[model samples]
Target: MANPYQPIEAQILKTIDETPTIRTFVLKPEQDVPFLAGQFVELTVPGHGEAPFTPSSSHFERETIEVTIMKVGRATTALFGLKAGDSVGIRGPYGQRYPLESFEGKDIYLVGGGVGLAPLRSLFLSLVHEIDKYRRVFLRYGARTPEEIVYKYLIPQWEKLKKVDIDLSVDVGDKSWVRKVGVVTCLMDDIPCDETSSIAVVCGPPVMMKFVTFKLVDAGFKPENIYLSMETNMSCGLGQCGHCRLGPYFTCKDGPVLTWEQIKDIPEPFV
Candidate 1:
């Protein structure tokens, strides 16, 4: 069996600047690394070390994986210094994936904030690929400011798709911005999906996820139908490390994708 700990080399094909602190790296791994939507990978910047990140690209496109990273700390900072043609190590398509099968024939509501939109992008693209299987798709996203919104170029294309609706908001807007100004949960006020039959997926900062979870529950969505992407401090991609334990579950093993029903009783689940 192949060693799960060993990382395969992937060459950076291109990089796109998303924000001052965030950039998207397009990488071509030496071998195909197929991953389901919401699964994460450990990216190694050689001598610096590896950090966990979920691919921002569609899972259907395995030839090249796009990872959107924010420059937060050591490993990410090191990754930023490298450019196209550079090589990095990639390990895993780890953790649980979003349950796409259950979403068929149902309205799909995706709520994301800031960089949390990254993983949701993967799910969104997958849904778009198989658009006919689902009912309607709704994307409601929010960023701290207009400048921090990722995938600025793709939103228009997504909006043009049939049965796909998008709502955008910014905490604070600039003169050039014309979208709604408020928290992401504000968009929940008039959700068009049937609360009883739709599935809601959320990914964002812990605080944002907390409030969104409350809003969805208050809006009458079942806990089991509300999925949360809890990509917290995962160390070893396997369950061996206790770094990402949340009550009885390991975020790295049992999930990075967990239903609200599974974690509602856990203390500070969003944290």
Candidate 2:
């Protein structure tokens, strides 16, 4: 068996600045790193260490992978210095993926905040790839301010697709912003799908997820039907590392994707 700890060399094909603190790197690995939506990868920044990140690109596209990262710590700061053509290491495509099969024939509601939108982009793209299988796709996203919104370039394109609807908001807005001004949860007030038959996927800051969960529950979304991307301190891509333990499960192994019902009883799950 191949050593799971070993990382394959990948070249940075390009980089796109999404915000002052966020950027997207397009990489071409020496070998294909196939992963389903919601799975994550450990990105190594040469001399610096590696950190876990979920790919922001569609899984259907095999030639290259895109990872959207926020420059918050040592590894990510080191990554910010590298440019196109620079080399990095990639390990994993780790953790459980979003269960796409279960979503078929049901309306899908995606709620994301700030860079949390990264992982959801992969899920959105996958759904769009086979648009006929699903009933409809509703995207509700919010950023702290207009400037911090990632994927600014693609949101319009996504909104134009048939069967997809998008609602955007910002905690604070400037003159150029014309969208709703409030938290992402505000967008949920006028949910266009049947709460009983739809699936809601959420990924964002812990605080945001916590409140969003409360709002969804209040809105009548079944706990099992609410999926969350809980990418906590996943130091290792394998289960042997105990850093990411949440009760009996390891985030890196059993999930980065877990249903709200599975974690609702865990004390401070959003924390």
Candidate 3:
């Protein structure tokens, strides 16, 4: 087994600005770091620190991985300043992956807001490879403003896929845009959420996630049937810290992706 505590070096191959405050770093690790979709890695900046981030790239492709980060604090600030060819340390593709098996024959609704789309993007990429295995895929993406939307470059391609319906909305639109204007939950009205055969995967800010959950429930999704990516202060990604604790579960060890029912008794994860 590899030393879970020691960080391995990974070189940044390229960086793409996803939004003004967000960037996606494409990395080439010295050795292959196998991981499943929805798992996260701890990345370290030599003199700065390490933080947990999910790989935005599909786990099926091991040659390289990407971490979509939003500049929010000191650690992320350092990450944002890094340029291509710079080195960073990484460890573990820790946490539970989305239950793809349970989703095999059900309709999948993917709801993401802002950078929360990172993990969902990874899952989407993995699922799309075997698109026919599922009944249908519906993506509803939201951003604070039109300028804040990430993955804008790929939506066109994703929309071209068969059996997939994709939509984008912003809390407020800009003069240059013409898409729907409203909170993400508003997108739910247009789709059918069959209680028996449809499941939803949601990720976003606390408020947004909370509202989306209520909307899904109102649309007939049972609590156990919905999955939420509740990434907290999962500092170690090794279950050694309590920062990411939710009641008795450690977000890093037991989850990152957990059914809504698993966390229903705890204080709201997003809160």
Candidate 4:
């Protein structure tokens, strides 16, 4: 058994400036770290402190992992200062993962917004590993501004996969932007998949998830078939702390990824 509280040593391999506010850290862990798609790890910046982050890398690769970060507060700000060769503490590959088994014969719709794409990217990479097992894949991404988009470098590769279609949009346009412009729900407009044979995964801000959920439902997705990644309020990777409470559930242990049916009754602000 591994100690949940003790962090393993991980060295930063490189850092990518995904956007002005977001950065992706590639690390070489001291030991093999195996985690499924949609799960997250606790990253400790030495004396600065530790915080939770989803590995943006493919789960198929255990020796290396990628964690994308946004400079929001103290912990992240400290994380931003570190560069390649810097040492950081790491623990866990915690929480529930997406139900790939259930998605085997189903079409997949991945909707990501801003940094929320981090976990979705992990899931996407995992799915692509066994692409022939599933039917089709539709990836729709939305950002506040084209400048805020992450993973632009991987777009071409993801689009090249067989039976996969990728589209990008922004809520607002800039002089340099020429793609579709609107909310993420706007991408959900045409209702691409057969609701009964498809599953939808969404990750983003609370408001974005809410509206996206509504859109998915209106587009014929069953409440049980839509999954949401609520990687928020996670102060403790273990379930001991109640910091990530969402009504009666713990976002850290019980979720980080939950179906709409599981969270629909959790009251307001939780969609």
Q: What is the C-alpha RMSD of each candidate to the true structure, in Å?
A: 0.8, 0.8, 1.1, 1.4
After superposition, which runs of candidate 4 have C-alpha atoms over 4 Å from their true positions?
A: none
On a 0 to 100 scale, what is the lDDT of residue 10 in model 2?
A: 98
Candidate 2 yields a Cα-based lDDT of 0.93
Assess every candidate by TM-score.
0.98, 0.98, 0.97, 0.96
lDDT of 4 by residue, 79-155 (tens): 99999999999988788988899999789999999999998899999998999889888999999998899998889
Q: What would you estimate as the lDDT of candidate 3? A: 0.88
* lDDT digits (tens) for residues 1-271 of candidate 1: 9887899999999999998998999999999888999899999999999999999999999789999998999999999999999999998889988888999999999999999999899999999999999999999999999999999999999999999999999999999998899999878899898998899999999999999999999999999999999967888898887998888999899988899999999888876
1 versus 3: better TM-score goes to: 1
lDDT of each: 0.93, 0.93, 0.88, 0.88
Candidate 3 Cα outliers beyond 4 Å, as residue runs: none
TM-score between candidate 3 and the true structure: 0.97
What is the alpha-carbon lDDT for the whole of candidate 1? Answer: 0.93
Pairs of colliding residues, candidate 4: none
TM-score of 1: 0.98
Which 10 consecutive positions of candidate 4 have the poorest summed lDDT?
Answer: 262-271
* Model 3 lDDT tens row, 138-193: 89999999889998898899999998889889998989878889989878786754
Error at 200, model 2, angstroms: 0.5
